[model samples]
Target: MRCTPPPERRDTAFALILTALFGACILLSIIIPSQICLARGGEAEEMNLSSDTALSKLTEGNESPAQEGIPVHVYITNNDNEKLDVSLFIDSELIDHKSISSGSDQKMDRYLLEKGRHTFKITWWDEDVKSSFEVEETRDITAETSVHLYTILNDKPEEYEITVNLVNENSRELEAFLYADGSFKKSKKVGKESSAELGKIKLKEGIHNLSVRWQDDDTKIEYEKTKKLMVKRD
Candidate 1:
């Protein structure tokens, strides 16, 4: 036969068991919630990192480049006594211009041109008479450049153009030198049976002298021709 413990000792053992059970329940509740929170936080951080990387790649894929050209300037003056309508062109492409009044000047500041030979043309007409005239010049530009043009409108023979008929019959290549009023204008090269261009210059209203000279060193042949041109103005 076994004897039972005293009442005080039995009650103390019961209290100890209850305390241990309560402690175990509290520990389980804290640990399980902490673990769940850690797992969810890690998943959220990974998802945010992936989104940022994709956004960075998409932004870097959509960039672009720069552009380039040559600078140019143009100055125009109207020398006549009437309102004139002017149209300008570069390489046969029309450029916009405003109508100029009598004895007025127009200045165009910065313009972009490509690096090559370009032709500049200006067409002007008298607003009252509707008579139109055109002048053009070509230049090979490697860098920055400037162009100056004058518009002249008159009824009389105020300006004259000098033309030379270059005839080459010799077997050897012949070159001719042109002179205006004893000043050298340009040189022309001519081949056998080919008509060559000698260029033209605007002459003021007067009696002008035009001459052409050519020399052949092999044949020792020197030749010169002179002509008098008269321009009349009203």
Candidate 2:
């Protein structure tokens, strides 16, 4: 007959086996989940980075200029009661012509214009009435500028005045010279965000010439403008 093992020894062996198995299970439970979470978190971070990159690209595209050109805004309004067929010209170049209904307004096609003075002309085409009225206007517009034009009847037909309004929209100051009838009238220095008026120049019943020469201290660019004013003496 074989000798039997001690009861305490057997009990100790069973407890050790159970403890080893429990430790293995606990380690698997903790380590497996941690690995899964790390994988998921890595994927989420990659996706977020891609999304942020796409958004940054979109913002940059929108901020950049559509084309390598300057921006100018031109607005035209029809204040007359009658419908008008309007023809618009810039520097004697025909840009657009359209029929505008009464009391309606329209915007012109945006195009980059050269800096300096430009002649703007508007002609009305009336089928019923043959009118010989044409409006000619001039302005010195820089890059990224907005200009407005309108018509106003003078109170006196014989004597009228033209107002020269100078505004320095640049960052630096500007030295300007005013000329009336081909003669230098005055000189002024206009600061940024400030405006200087050359005052109302009285004119007799004739065509008068007005011009301005200015130098921008920031850009060091010299700009000049010449416009004609026609006055009818009653």
| Candidate 1 Cα misplacement greater than 4 A, ranges | 1-42, 46-65, 155-234
Worst 10 residues of 1 by lDDT: 9-18
* Model 2 clash number: 0
lDDT (tens digit, per residue) of candidate 2 on 1-234: 222122220001000000234234334333432121224533632112233443354346445455655666666676665667777788898888777766676776676877778888776754434443467878886668765444222222345665677765656666768777888877777776667775666666777777777765556667776767676644
- State the RMSD for candidate 2: 37.0
Report the Cα RMSD per candidate.
37.3, 37.0
Cα shift from native, residue 10, model 2 (Å): 99
Q: Residue by residue across 1-234, what tens digits does model 1's lDDT show?
A: 222222220001000000334334334333432121224533632112233443354347445554456887877788878777788888898886778877888874567888999888888876544577888989887998898888875754456665556656556667777777898888877775556666767777788787777787676677777768776654
Best by lDDT: 1
- lDDT agreement of model 1 with the native: 0.64
lDDT, model 2, position 160: 62
* TM-score for all models, in order of appearance: 0.41, 0.35
Candidate 2, 117: how far from true, in Å?
1.3
